[model samples]
Target chain A: MTTDLVVVLDADGRALRGRAPKLASEQLTAIYDAMVRSRVLDEGASELGPDELSHYEPTHGREAIDVGATFALQDSDWIVPRKHQPAALLARGVLFEELANAWLGKIEDPTMGRQLPGHYSFRSANFLSTSSTAGSHLSHAVGAGIGARARGDDTVFLTFCDVQGTSSNDFHAGLNLAAVHKAPVVFVVEHAPWEASERETASATIAAKGAAYGIPGVRVDGHDVLAVYRACREAVDRARRGDGPTLVEACTWLTDGDTPAWRCEDPIKRFEQHLAHQKLWDAAIGQRHFDTATAELAEAIALARTAGDPDTESLFDDVFMNLSPQLREQRRELARTATTTTIQP
Target chain B: MTATETRPGVKVMTMIEAISDALRTEMKNDDRVVVFGEDVGPKGGVFGATAGLHEEFGETRCFDTPLSECGIVGAGVGMAVYGMRPVAEIQFLDFIYPAFDQIVSEAAKMRYRSGGEYTCPMVIRSPYGGGIRGGHYHSQSSEAYFCHTPGLKVVIPSTPADAKGLLISSIRDEDPVMFLEPKKIYRHGKGEVPLGEHTVPLGRARIARAGTDVTLLAYGAMVPVCEAAADAAAEQGRSVEVVDLRTLVPLDEQTIVESVKKTGRCVVVYEAPKTCGYGAELAAILAEKCIEYLEGPVVRVAGFDTPFPYTLEHLYMPDEKRVLAGIDKTFAW
Candidate 1:
C-alpha cells in the first residue's frame, strides 16, 4: 500500500532534510488560502435550501488533492475535475461570484442553469466540464491530451477520480488509449477504500492499474499538500515531455471518522500543523484567512441571490448553432403559453 | 493543406466509397478534421468505409482505437470540445450502446450544458439498419435513440450522393451530429456522386420519386424499400411519392407535410420496431399537421415489435412486400 515514491513529509511539513519541492512561501500561502476558501464555500452550500443542498456534495476532507493537482498545471493545460472537486476550479481562478451563480442556478450562470451545483466548466480557464457520472471524464482527458498532441501543443490534461472510479470501464479505456497513443495525460485518484465497501481492504491499489497500460503509477499521501503537488508536478512534467500518462493515487480517507486512527489525518489540519511548525502560521493569520473566505462566500451568495432565474427564451438557445425550423416552431409555441408558475402536470 | 484529387466530372461510387471520399476530402480541406475508430486505420475499417484514410492522413490524423466504444466516443467528445472536428466511427450502430452515455449525456449536452461556452462539433458515423443477415448484434436501426436526445443532429443518408454530401455537411456542422450510415447499402447502393465540394445541408429531405397517390416516407435503408414498393405500386397503377428523410432530428417536416398534402395518403416505412419507432413520430406529426390533407390514417410499415431474430430476419424487416402492403392499405382507406 506504500512505496518509496511516496514523498513523506515530517510533522513539521519540512521534507526529510532537503527533500521538499521548492515552493515559494507566497505560493504555499496561496495554496493554503485556496483550500480554506473551498472549505468555506462547501460549508456555506451545505446550509442552503433543500433544492440547492440536493446538488451540493461536500469535498470536505480532500482539498489537498484538489488544490495541489490543479495548481501544478499551466493555464494552457486542461483539468477535468470530478463533480466533488469544485476546489480545482477555485484553484484555477474561477471567480467566486460566478461559481455561486452557477451553484444557485441563477440567470447569470455560465451554464444557464443546465448543470447541477458543483459541476463547473470554464472553457477560457482550460477546465473541462465535470460530469455527474463516475469515471466518465477520464476518456475526455485522454481525448484532450490527444487533441493537444495533434495540434503540436505541449498542453497536458489532468483528470481526477475517486478510488472506485478505477474500476470503471472508462478508466481502463482512457488509460489504454493514452498508453497506445502516448498521450500526455495525468490521472489523479483520491483513494478511499471504504467508499467502495466497509469490508473492502486495500487489496489492489489504484496505482497498480497503470501497469496494464505500460504507464508509470505512484502513490502519495493525500494529507500532504506538498507531497501531492510534487507527484502531480512530476507527472505533468513527464506528460509535457511526451513521456505519456502517469497515474498518481493520492491515498486519503474521504470521511473524518472512517476509522479511529484516520480521524487525525484531515488534510487541512495536517497542513495547518505543518505551516505552524514552519513558522508560517499563527492564530491571527489563520483567523484572517478564514474570515476573508467566509466574507467572500457570503458576498457571493448575496450576489447570486440577486440574480434572476434564466430567461424562458434561453431554454431554446445553445441546442444548436442555430435553432432548426422545428425548434423555432416549438419555441414559438412555448413562448405563447409560457408562465412564471411551474405547472404541476 | 494537400488538395483532394478532384475528378473531371461526376464520379460513380457506392455509398461506402462516397463516405470514404467525403472523409478524405474533409481531412484534406481542414487540418482540424480527425477520423478514428476500430479497424479504421490500417484495416480501412471492417466495411472498408475508412479505406486508405490511415495511409493518406498518417497515424496521428487517422488511426485505430482500442475495442472500447465508450472510449472512442468519450474521447471524440473531449477532442471536439477542445477545438477539433473529430469524426469517430462506431463499427456498427448496435455496438454504440456501450458509448451511449458519452453520446447522450456528454456529446449531446456539452453545448447547452456549458451554455454555449463549449461546443462539441463531432461526427459519430456508424453503420446501421438490418438486411445483410448479420443478425441482432451486427444489425440495428437505432437512429431514434439519438433523434430523441436534444442538442444532437441525427442524419441518415439514403443515396451514395447523399452520403457524400450529407457527411461533408455533417463534418462542417457546428454541433454534434450522429451520422447513421445504412450498412445495408454500403456497397449495394451506387449512384453518381458530385466530383468535389458537394454538400447537402441537414434538416432537408429529398423526394426520390414524384407521384400523386400516396406519399411514401422513408430514410436510411428503408428509402430503397420504399422505392421498390413505389415501383410495385406503379405496376398496380398507384402513384406513390417517396420521401427520403435525410436528417431525422431537424426532420424536414415542411417537406413531409408538403408531400403529404400533395398526395392525400401517407405511408411511413422504417426497419426499426413498430412501437415507439421513428415512424410513430412521423405518424404523429402527420396527424397533427396534415390531418385534413390525409386521405387515410397514417399507416406505418416497420419491423415487428420484437428482438431482431436470426431465422426470421427477412420477415422481421419491412421489405418491399410490407411497404406495398402499407401503400395498398392506405389506398384502400
Candidate 2:
C-alpha cells in the first residue's frame, strides 16, 4: 500500500547547503538587494503596537514573506500587506519613509490616521489595504487575483502568518473561499512557530495541512532567497495560467534582531553566508549594501520623526467622510473643550 | 414607477414557476443579468426556478457553481461590484450562513465603504421560511438574520404579483437584496401576476385589508395568516387592518406607523423564532417611534424560541389561531 504525503522543508537550514541555479550577476544582485532592503526596512519599521509608537520589534520566523514573495510576484503586481508583513510590504514597494511616517502615526499614513500603525494601505498601488482582523483581508487579495485573471495580468501574491491559535472563523472562511473559487492567489503561510508563542503546528508538515483542502503545498527554505523565489514563481505561474491557487509554506527562522513584536531573521546574511561558500559575490559588496541601507534608513527616520506632528484636533477628520450634524457638533464641543484646557508643559 | 394594476386571477402554478417567471422576465429585460449557484444551472436549480434559464440564455449567463457558499457569495459580490447584475441563488437559505461574511460585510458594505465608489446592486434569492417541513437543516426562517444587517435590503413577498414585481425591483435596486420566497406559498397560494415586465420599488408596503380597530403588520407566509386572523377577528366583531410589508428591511416604517395610528392597536407577526426575530425589530420600532399613536402595547406573534421543530411545526409556526390570540392579547391590554 502506498500513502501520499508532501514534505515541507524537512531539511534543516543548519545542515542543508546547495548551489543556486544559473542567473546573471545583476539579477542575483537585485534579489540580494531586495533581501537586504527587506531586512533594513524590517529592522527599522514597527509593525504592531500603538498608533504613534510601533516600537520596532523585528519579525521573527517568517523570512519567506520577503525573500521568497518578492521574487514570487512580478514588479507591477499589487500586494496587500497585512499588519505583520513589513518586510513583504517594503519589498513590494512601500518606501522606508512611508513605513516610518506610518509608524509616527502621521496624517499622511495611508490608513488615514484611522486604523493602527502597522495596518498600511495604498489604494493606487493595486494593493487594497490591511487590517488586524486575522484572515479577513485574504478574500480581497483573492478578488484582486480574479481581476488579474480577467485582465490577463500574470499573477498576484498574498501572504499570511498562520498561528493555528488564531484559527478563527476568518482563517477557514478566507482560505476556503480561495480554494473553492480556484482564484489566482498564492497563499504563503509563514508557519510561525513558538516566539509568538511556543506552540508547534498540529501537523508536522505544511503539505499535510494544505492537502486537507486539496491544494498543492510545497515548502521552501525561507532563508534562501533563490529557493523561495523559485518555489513562489512556480505557484504564481500556476495561478496565472488558471491552474488554481497554491499554498506555499516557506519554513523560516527568527534571528538576533527579531523582537517579539515583528521579528524576522536576516535572510540577507544567511544568503550571503551561503553565497560566500558558493563563490557568488565578494563579501565586501554584501557588506556595502548593508552599510548603505543603514545610513539611508537613519536619515529617513529623522524626516519621519519631525514631519508628522499630530494633536488631538487632528483626529476629527475621516471618522465620517462628511460628518453628520451630530458628529459636527461633537467635534465643535471637543475643540472648545480642548481650547479651555491647559498643558502641563 | 407606473401603477400597472393587475387584477386578481386564480393561477395554479408551483412556487418555483412563479419564481422562474420573475427571474425569466427580469433576465429578458436586462442584458447585464447573470445567474449562478449550486445545482442552479443545467439542473435549472434543484427545484427548477432556473429550469428554462440555461435554455433561454447561454451557459455563460446561468451556470452551476462549486458547493462553496462563501465562494459563491464572494464571487457574486465581486460580480455585482464590477457591473453585472448577478442573481445568486443559494440552493437553500439554510446553506447561506457559510457565505454570511461576504453577504453582510462585503456586499452590504461596498457602497458605504467606497463612499459610493461602488455598489453591490444584485439579488440573492433563496427558498426561505420553512413551512414545507424541510427538516432542521433544510427548513429555517432566516429573513430576520439578513434584516438585522444594514446596507442590505430584505424582501419577502407573499403573493405572485408582489413576488414578481419585488424581485424585478430588487434586481435593479442599486443595493444588495436578500429576496426570500416563501417555499410553501409557491403552489398553494395563487393570484394574478401581471403578464409583462414590472417592478415594485423597495421600501413600499401594501395594505392587504383595511379595518379600523386594529392593525396587523405581517410579511412573507404570515401575510395570509394575518388575513385569516382578520377574518376570524371580524367574526368576533373586531375590525382588523392587514399591512403586508413586502420589503422588510428598508421597512416602510411609515406604513407600519400610519396603520398603527389608524387601528390604535397592532400585532407584529412572523414565522421566524421569537428571539431577536424581525418581529422584535417591528415591535421596538413601533414602541419607541410610534408610542403615542398606539392605544395598547404592540404584541408580536412568532415561532417558538426553539430551532424550527419538525414534529410540532404547526406549533412551531405562527398561524391564524395564534395570530388572533396575539391580536386578542393586544386588544385586552
Candidate 3:
C-alpha cells in the first residue's frame, strides 16, 4: 500500500534529506499554528455538543492533509471539501468566530443555521458550499476549474475527498470530464481506508485510478505535512498551467491517535519535532500557539452561545432572488401566527 | 438587464429555432452565457435546438459534454457559482432523473444553502412531452418534479415567440431555471417571433384565446391543444378562454384566478400523468381561490396514470378531443 509514496518526514519527525519542501521558518510556524488551531477547534467543539463532536472526532488524524493542501493553494483558488475540513477552512482565512457560530447555529451564522455544524459555505474565501450527500461536489470542482479557465484567469480548484469517494459515480464523471475538457482542477483524497477492507482495495492504490482517466496521480504520506504540501503544490502548479487535473492521494488512517503507534502518526507532534530539529521550536512558542488557539476557540464558543437563534422570519429569505407574491402571503401567514401567540396566552 | 423591449423586425420561427435564437442572442450580448450538453456542439443537440451555436460561439462557449446527465448539471452548477450563466441541455426530460439530485440538491439549494452569497443562475433546457413517437425513454413530461422543488423556476413556453422570450428571461433570471422545452411542438409550434432582445417576464400568464364561458389552463405543448379546443368550443357557442401559464413556480396566480373567476369554470390540461400531476396543483389553486366563482368542478384533462407507451402514446396524451370533453365536464357541472 506504501508503493511510490513521496515521504518527506518520518514517523519520528525527522525530515528525509533533500525531500522536505523549502518553507521559511514563519511559513512553517504558520502551518503548525493552523494545524494546532484545527486540533483545538476539533477538541473544543466537544464542549459545544457531543452530538456534533461525534462526527468530528473520528476524522481527526488527517489535519496535515487539510492544512498542507490549503497552504499549497493560492487565495484565488476555490476549495470544494467533500466533507468538513475545519483546518483547511481556517487556513483559507475563515474566522474562528464564524466557524463557531456555524457549529452553534447562532443567528450570526453566515449559513443562517441552514446546515449542520461542519457543512460550511464561505464564498468570501472561495470555499464552495458543502452538502451531506457524498461525491456530489466532485463535478462542482471540475466545473469551477472550467469556469475559472473560461474567465481567462489561471485560477485552479482543489477538492478534498475521502478514500471511498473514488468509488462514487461523480468521481469517475468529474475526473473524466476534467481530463476531457482539460479543466484546471486538483483532486486530493485523504486515503484513510475506514470502510473498504484491504482485500477489497489491495490490487492497486487509489492513485493508480487517475491513469484510467488520463490524469497523473501521486501518492504521499498524509501524516507528513511537507510531503502532502509538495505533492499538492506540484499538482496545483500543473493545473494552473493548463495541464488539466492531477489526483494526489494523501494516505493516512482513521484513528483517535491515543495508542503508541497511532501517537507517532500524529501530524502535529511530528511537525513540532521537525521544527525543533531545525532549531525553530521552543517551549514558550509552542505553549503560546496552543494556548492562543484554545483561548480563541473558547471565546468564539462563548460568544456564539450568547447569541440568539436565527429570526423565524428569515426562514423565508433566499428561497429566490426575491420573494414571490405567494411567498409574501406565506410570510404574512407566519407573522399572523407569531402575533396570535400572545392572544392565546 | 431585463430585455422587455425588442427591435422592430420580427421573424417567423419554430419553437426549436426560437430557442436557438434566444441562446445566440444572449451569448452575443453577454460573454458569460455558455451552452453545453451531450451532442450540443457539432451535433447541435439531438433535436437541433442548439444548431450553429458551437460554430458561432466556438467550442468554449458552446461545446459537448460526456454522456452523464449528472456531470452536465453538476458542472453547470459549478460554472454558475463561478459567475457564468450556463444553459445545460439534458437531451430529454426522461434522462434527467440521473441528474435530479444535482438539480434539486445542488443547483436549487445553492442560493439558500449558501445564504445568498452563491447562486446557480443557470438553465437546464430539456425536451419533454410524449409526442414525436419517442416513447418513454425519449419522451415523458416531468416538469412537475422540478416545479415541486423550491429555489427553482419551472418555465414551459407554449408558442415560438414565447419560447424565445421566455428562454431569454430564464437565462437572465437570478435563480435556477428548469427550461422544459416541448419536444412534441419543437417544430410544429411555429409563429412570428421577435428578431432580438425580447423578454416575456416570468410568473405571468398569456391569454391565448379570450372567451367567457370557461377557462382552460395549460402550458408548453398542451397550450396549442387548449387553444384548438377553445376554438372548437367557440363554434358550439361555449366561449372558452385558453390561459398559457409560461412560468409555473413564481406562478401568475392572479391571472389564472381572474380568468377562472370571470369564466366561472376551469379545465386544467397537461401531458403528464393524472395522479399528482402539475394539473392537480392548478385544480387545487382554483378550488381554493376561485371556489365561489366556479360553475363546475375543476376538470383535469391529462395522460392516464400509466407509463408513456410507444404505440399507445396517442391514447395516453390529452389532445383537442380530450380537452373538449374536459370543457364539457365543466359545463355539465
Q: Quick one: best DockQ, which candidate?
A: 1
lDDT of 1 by residue, A1-345 (tens): 344447647655666666678888888788888898888988888778977545777777788888988888888888887786778887877778988998888888888988888788777678787788878899999998898789888999999888667778899899999899889999998876347633433445677778878999888878788889999999999999999999998877423233423534667777777778777888899999999989988999898888899977788889998988877887778766877623221
**lDDT of predicted model 1:** 0.86
lDDT for predicted candidate 3 compared with the true structure:
0.86
Pairs in clash, predicted candidate 1 = none
Against the correct fold, how does model 3 do in TM-score?
0.95
Q: Residue A114, candidate 3: how far off, in angstroms? A: 0.8
lDDT tens per residue, model 1, B279-320 = 999999999997998888899888888888887898898889
Residue-level lDDT of model 2, residues A70-157, one tens digit each, is 6567766656445656666656556777777766766556554444556565544444455455555555556555545444556564
Clashing pairs in 3: none
TM-score against native, each model: 0.95, 0.76, 0.95
| Candidates 2 and 3 compared by lDDT, better number | 3
The alpha-carbon lDDT assigned to residue A266 of candidate 2 equals 52
Candidate 3 per-residue lDDT, tens place, B1-333, comes to: 112234358777888888988999999999999999999998899988888889998988999999999999999998999999999998888999989999999999998987888999999999888879998898788888888999999999988899999999999999999999988888884688998799999998999889999999999889888888888888998998899999999899999999999999999999898999999999898888879999889998998889899998888888999999888888886
How many steric overlaps are in each model, in order? 0, 8, 0
Model 3 Cα shift for residue A137 (angstroms): 0.5
Query: Which parts of model 3 are misplaced by more than 4 Å?
Result: A50-59, A197-203, A254-264, A339-345, B1-8
Q: Between 2 and 3, whose TM-score is larger?
A: 3
Off by over 4 Å in 1: A3-5, A197-202, A254-263, A341-345, B1-7
